[model samples]
Target: MFPASKQAIGMDLPAGMTLLLTLGVSGLILYLSIRTSWIWRHLPPGPTPLPLLGNIMEIGRSDVANSLKKFSDKYGEVFTIYLGSRPVVVVTGYKQVKEVYLDKADDFLGRGDLPAWNNFYKSQGVIFTDVLEWWRELRGFSISSLRDLGFGKSGTEDGIQEEAHCLVEELKKTKESFIDPQLCLRKAVCNINLSTMFGNRHEYEDKDLVVVLSCIQNTFAAANSSWVQEKANPNSVFTRSHLLSSALQIFFAGVETTSTTLYYSLLILLKYPDICAKFQKEIDHVIGPNRCSTIKDKSSMPYTEALIHEIHRFIDLLPLGVPRKTVREVTLKGYKIPQGINILPLLSSVLKDPTCFKYPAEFNPENFLNEKGEFQKNGAYMPFAAGKRNCLGEPMARMMLFLFLTTIFQNFDLKSSVPFEELDITPLVSGFGNLPRNYKCAFITR
Candidate 1:
């Protein structure tokens, strides 16, 4: 056996190793703390973030829009928030957002790499791609092609009218029974894009169409598996992957937003019958029941026009807007945001800015109306975002909303199956998009 002192030394060796390990970890944490502070010092002011996780714990999982708004209240109109190790600078309020998105458009034109979008499409399409030349070419082609095909022009109105008729026919089958109109509205909206893109519209029960819809739906739901296979030639600027990705982009943005907006509009009408009455009265006087509603009738129906604008504002879809990045190191609103920093232009803040509207929170059409009771426009209205990267599908979406809502309400008297008070207009999901909760309603013929 060894002496007592020698044995004690052997035991103390393991304890010494443990102490060194602890100190190493402590030193690392201290270093990271210093490094993070140094980096943040050059950027805009924001809440203190923890190492590695950044502000994820503070942002939480639900209602990120509101969470960012809370941070904005404390941090001012222009502030920074970290996503993991990445820093995102959020610009709130109308003036600041306008300054960044409008005045300094080119500086903030880069599309920040979003993990979800990168995994799905790998930045191949117009929406998520950072290739400036590709975006220009694609956007130019899309606008021209869509215009040629009568997207925002008068030529496409017939197609919209046809789809509107189909929707009315589908609702008629519900025959006083309570039916969730979400799927039908989705099919109608998807078919419009399908017809526009492929010159073919799928039936509501078509299997192939269902699979395509499922893929588009999964994209928003954050399903990561490869949805569309690449099919373009290697030599072309618009590769097979680019084509597939662009088509998917168009389908996802085209279908979801227009359908969700229509659904919300109907839900709002169901909740407030008085508003519906005024809307129907306007529709009756302007379009009449003899023929389908046209875009030309929009000007004559001030109430209807106001209601549509109000819906766009109140719904506040894409609340955070798409994350954009600074192409180069730029100073915005006295803050030095470094190059490649993600920018979240808080669109919801602009839509709901109290200074811009009389009652921002309440769903009031008067918000879009002047003192003369005529439909008016607000500069703060930016549901499709603003700038060079504003939504490519805005014109199509506007036409679709006007035609579909007017057509449906013109044909049928909408009534909720449940009590109006019990109906939940709150979105079921509130992350990238504001998706309204599913509700049923009846469509009785006028």
Candidate 2:
């Protein structure tokens, strides 16, 4: 190495100039970031923030839900908030949330696909783009594609039947007497996606596909973390384009959310064995023992339908709800909110609100049943979300859930290693999605 004294003295002027320039540039970036969109000018009341880090320092990992709950108590549902330089408007109450999602959906129908999302996926796809015109075009493509793959009526029932056969066979081969319903459900639900979109039934043994699917889970699981925001920014975690982020969004939203909901249906049934027995009796009398389950059978099975509705209502996967962004400046309740503010829909607050569902905490199918024991659709009971931006897969999802779940009950009993209450459905936060922490269950041969 060169002599320290000689090198230091020789490079003195250049080094000093470099140091001065770095300090000046840092000062400018800090000033610009603060001036841009700090909570002080735009965000509504909640918490004070520290410089550079914002209110991030005040938050602990496990304390998020509790923190949001506290804010809900104080701010009265829809309130302005912040995450870093971004301004956020948190809408907690269902009435307020329904307004944004249903009543004024045109202005608030889309979410800002953070730079990370656009870079990774290019975001040309339906889910990432906030534009209504674009979403319709893409949704039309997706629905039509699914219909062609047999998604509606009994058209997609053929795919489900073939996949269900594979699912039962896989369970038989494992024959462990105990298995994680998580993996089995993934195989079943994912196969449905594959037989339709990826053009073949995804195998249980395709480790690469499993890895990709696991990555999708891992990414969505990061919902509570800042990485979701970070990755949403351009060229950060996964890619410099929205392509990866968009693909990721579609996969997880498509897979895990629905998969967990299906798993809950089984869990709820097993815990209330009497209810399960009653449902089985209904199915036996109607759909019968010899024939496979189908969407055609759904109309005849009221109890089964009610149970599915109850599951969606009680087991809400998105606790923070799907965050949306305003297309432009708007005012609600005398609050002058500007465009691009992050919006949290408080779907959990809505679904769990006692006013909406009697004895909301407890699992009761009657909430979805009428005085006559007929299946009733609760407009307030929206798990796949609501409004113009409601889940595009709603129609197909309905068909698949009825068929697949019935197929399982017809063939086997879904048992957990422990009692259903013993299994925790309390969500673990991922980037922007909430997932069941543990979904271990067994397939009891009928």
Candidate number of the best lDDT: 1
lDDT values for all models: 0.84, 0.68
Candidate 1 TM-score, C-alpha based: 0.91
Per-prediction TM-score: 0.91, 0.79
Error of 1 at 38 (Å): 1.4
Among all windows of 10 consecutive residues in model 2, the one with the lowest summed lDDT is 235-244
Cα lDDT of model 1 by residue, 139-191, tens digit = 77667766776677665788999999998988898897888898889899988
What stretches of model 1 exceed 4 Å from their correct place? 1-13, 216-236
lDDT of 2 by residue, 1-446 (tens): 85679777867678789899889989987786667545336455666544456566554555354466677788767665556655567777667878888888887866664666567545556677665565665566555645665656564678888887777788877574776677777767876765565566667888755765666545334431432344554633322222334444556566776777777677667677787887888888887776887776778888888888887777776666667888877776557677777787777778777777766788788888888999987767877789877776777677777777777778777676787656655556533455546655667777
Off by over 4 Å in 2: 1-43, 58-60, 63-66, 113-119, 130-137, 202-252, 419-421, 428-431
RMSD of each: 5.1, 7.9
